[model samples]
Target: MTRIDSLRAGDPPRIGGYELAGRIGEGGQGSVFLATAPSGDQVAIKLLGSALTGGDDDPGPGFARESEILRRVAPFCTAQVIESGLLEDRPYIVSEYIDGPTLQQVVEGEGPLEGARLRRLAVGTLTALTAIHRAGVVHRDFKPSNVLLGRDGPRVIDFGIARALDAVATGSGVVGTPPYMAPEQLEGAQVEPPADLFAWGSTMVFAATGRPPFGMDSLPAIVNRILHRDPDLGLLRGDLRDLVAECLSKDAARRPTAGEALMRLLGARDRPVGFLLSAGSAAASGSPAPPHIPDSGDAPALSPGASRPPPGAGARSRARRRAAILGAGVTVALASGALVHALTRDGAPARPEATGPARPLPEVTSVPPPATTELRLPGLGTTLHENPGDTARMVSFMYDSKGGSNHYARVRGTNRFEAVAPWQEPLPSPDGTWLALLPWLKESTPQPYDFVRLVHVPSGREYIVRLTDKPLQNFNPAWSPDGTRLLLTTFDLSSGSRTPVGFAIVDAAAAKATLVRADTSGAPAAAPFAWSPGEPAVALPFGAGPRAGLRFFDLNGRTLRTADGVGEAAASESPFAPAGKRFATGCPGAFASVCVWDTATGRALARFRVPAQSAFIGWYNDAHVLLTDKSADPHKVVVMDMKGEVLRVLAEIPREEPGENRGTFLFHYMRWS
Candidate 1:
């Protein structure tokens, strides 16, 4: 259930009333020993390691002061202290050993908690703070790593005794993790409950987004941001968003009291979980529940060859003592380039250019697939019948006037479609072997917390690839010709404006991704781009920003070519022709006009005018182009030939009510079977 470390040589077998078993946890200040109490119950005894003992065999005045206060804290959503004593002038405190992972472990591995789990995490920790403050004890170092996600609820650890470390906050010495420290604490001023509340808000941000609200940085830089900058909490919403921002107020006196913050959370607990939640309520029961109860902490550390500690392992000081803490639990198998070419079009496809070096990106890995009974995904909206013999598949968040939205899947056929799982923005691979689910599909956290979830079609296995760590948004994911890589464009936020920056190429199996044609020196280019399917080049739009359209970039961040006279290619449209030689996109103005470009010559070949208020989807074939009209009763797909002739129309996808904002939501991104 949690990552446990084994005993090592030179470890003392016994300390007073406890028999030391193994090393369970190691922090900057002390080593937690998993030991047996006098009555045989398991307990964690934290003894000051040699680093803090100072080779004098005695912990100074700090230890005695810590021991006196810890004894007063009773058990109530916190680890209950059993006893504290000195052995050979060395100090140790024994408490009930909680068997769960740290809050950091849960968010880092799971990627920003949601649903009842996130609620339980919030309410439980606040309850702990209420109880701790009620007892007149302040947990100065409240952070993600210090909160243990127990099975029953969240338990705040490292509460009363952390003061023994006596680490300062001003100048060079930081008493706690800088990102979680309040402005007053960072200023080395006298701190109280408000300081801890400030840390609580920062912890909530990390629990909700897998990163600190202020972003990671050096100690000096973090202190500067803490004083001048507000947290980048664009991913959070509703009550949690407002509360976190309030607690993080730069003015110490402006921060809410712990009890006041608790009442605010309890108020939110009484209402609907808001638009950010998966459903109107958190769990199926629909009754208000404790917010932090569902945060289940999994195993600890990395298996082998992990060059770095996972998530919250880095707390307090910059230096960490590395040991064999993380054991093997789950692993991802790399199976790249096993895809069979699915479809081929007859055309004079241009020769793809020789690629340069590749950027080393982190690989996406799979977890053990969740086991469940056969799922029935019903009501997948209007199905478009494809070639009877074709095997291509499509996935959508089925929206019915009566039923609302549900995850549904169907191949391009009249065959009965079924629901596989509840996920959003599903894009099947060109080969139909895998389905890529966008992270923002089911959850409501902003783009920064989004992930690219890939599911195996046959086994229903799912893997996640974190697209970007920065507070950014992305859309329009297109699979490569081989189905091994995925292309998506990144958007940056500056002064409250979100603009497209550059296109990212993701290796699904490897879980690594890199951006192309992005401005490395200045702000990233804010424009959409589409891959040429089989080639190394991509077609991007031209806009008021750098790296805008009429430009082609290779897989590696290099600009290949640029064309003229093509309208600003929107991210919603791809330019590559079915044969992969020409580019097509909607015009820049209010009129519905389609512009096609020759990829080889960077020249406009033809321009066709269509009915107003229509979008250019893509080319069905070399001669036939596909378009969609929103004004129709049912959304109609219009097919036009290269000669500007109206060829035919396909089925319409029912439109939702006007004014409903589905961020970057489109009809579908269909890949060949």
Candidate 2:
């Protein structure tokens, strides 16, 4: 590992819960310091530059983009972000530190890569891109230097922030290196995921040949070569050569998606798709696991001394040496996508070939079940099932804006109010940085559904997603415990209340949504359900009134066959814990009683009649049940230790009206910070 230096003259000793060890790396946007977490884990804390963070009250896009993206694509092929908070008014983010050398250092020092080694690098990086895309994000600055070849494998870093910065106009200083830039980028055009593919091709070419696709040259010359010339592959052959060429296709539409690229790189038509793979971690008990890590031979590792030249040597120097090495030449007309053409230096034709024949890469529409689950949760009963630290630590609420046009939310007990329409409810993410707003399109109108608009509260940035190709409506957006995915119920708005539609799992970043088949009974519609806080199964309402029972579905929305009695009981109004093995709900027509059910069997394990006119709030933990005694003076909530003995009264609230309940969190995931 590279040695960690001591704090410099300007460095702060501590930030939030992390203590600085020393500066490990620095980039154009910020400085990265090796730090120690309160729990003693090693972390890399990045202090963002002032230009990106914005003024004290208003931060720019890149300031929060990386954290938001990392939060959504964690535990995959990335250095997961742990927490983010300001230090002395400047923003800082701490992420799990990956000890490894960049792809640049490895290839540069070890010479050109080939065979299994090259295959591994390609597969690993491609898989990383796939995961990022799956989460609704695009890595605009995807180059060798941004990839860390760790002990476990390659991890993609600096994703969203780069994209946001790269979007800034070129004359003001573009974010990415010119040699690795797509032609469209150089032409000052709009960039997207397709741009990443072009950069990926350049990266692969550099890795395999120890030179950029375009030979190293002056900036003007490199720009000309990129726009007008075809990369000189020079002896590069086989499937690798073909794939790289396709990735560098002048036409963006002709390029394959990250997923498709991965599938083709592994030869989908040849293997079982995952014909060769690395053993990846299993999914959270009973949930769908992520894609496999491609199995490949051991590649050369980056030694501590393998660190590249410092900033004093300049980023352009390393970028030039590792990116474009083409001779000087210059122009071409602007076009769609990130590619261009040119008239040669001596006014010759650009090149005879068109980025190969426009062959399409195989598309992987969905990720197939790779392996059987090895971890099973004991569905003993429901208690507090989710990580409630963040929610439990603060009381989130909404208030009238004194007859103003919109309502406001007191986020995280910060006393800082954010204006949200009365039609919206502020459900903060587990990290407390984002708030998911479920707004009724027409609150005064009697509509059957609503859509969610995710807002980064601190930055005021929002991601409004359509979730469909047509003008469809969605409702009841539920945030998963990790806040990476959202569970939504789709409604055929035209169908009215007489029918039921289905459910969908949305990638919070990319806005890509998949419809899940939750209604096996073929009903026209169904009520929205709450995910069991942690796993894939959700407790959904199948029918109406007392006749309605709860059905469980996996993340893909496939019905899971449980004990026959399980679906026979009515779903309670209280929220299910994230990983609860048991659940507690009050009997519908009761003399006021609380009941705990075996989530897997639909069998009641315990029942306790509470004081008159009371309702079950939720389970405090696996051993305790929380219920409200409305019959008591006003309404008092009490926690019972499962043995019918009252342990403690948690809180007291005003009596709720017959059809109105002031609390819904009793049914949602909550965590104490």
Best by lDDT: 1
Expressed as tens digits, the lDDT of each residue in 1-673 for candidate 2 is: 4446778898888888788888877887788899888888999888876665344454434445555655676345566667666666466777779888888888888887775456667777887777677677777788888888776556677776665443321335455788888888788777778888888889999888888897778999998888988987755666668888988877788888887786555433222211111124121222222322222221111113222111121111222221111121211110000011111112111222112112111221121112222211111111212122211221233321111113234334332333343334445555444455554222211111123555543344455433422113455555666656766665443322313345666565554456554554633143455666345666565543334356666765667653332222222322343236665543433334545566666665665555544444454455654554545444444555554566554443433333322211111223412
lDDT of 1 at 76: 50
Q: Each model's C-alpha lDDT?
A: 0.56, 0.51
**How much is the lDDT of residue 349 in candidate 1?**
20
**Clash numbers, per candidate:** 20, 41
What would you estimate as the lDDT of candidate 2? 0.51
Which runs of model 2 end up more than 4 angstroms from their true locations?
52-57, 60-62, 164-173, 270-673
lDDT of 1 by residue, 1-673 (tens): 6666778897788998799888887877778988998898999888876555555544546577666677676455678778877666567888888888899888888788764467657767887787778778888899998889775567888886656555311123546788999998888787788989899999988887888888786877888889998787857776678888999999878988876676455431222212111222121122221212111122211213322211321111111110111111111110111111111011112222222222211221121122222222344334353343221122343331112234444543333454433324556666555566664221122112235656544443445555543334455567766776787766543222335666666666665555443532322233455665456766665643223356666656566666644555522436676556666654434234555666676565666665554555555555555655544555555556654555555434544444322112233434343
Q: How much RMSD separates candidate 1 from the native structure?
A: 20.9
Clashes of 2: 41
Name the regions of candidate 1 deviating beyond 4 angstroms. Answer: 1-405, 411-414, 420-423, 441-450, 515-517, 520-526, 544-549, 570-573, 587-590, 643-646, 656-665, 669-673
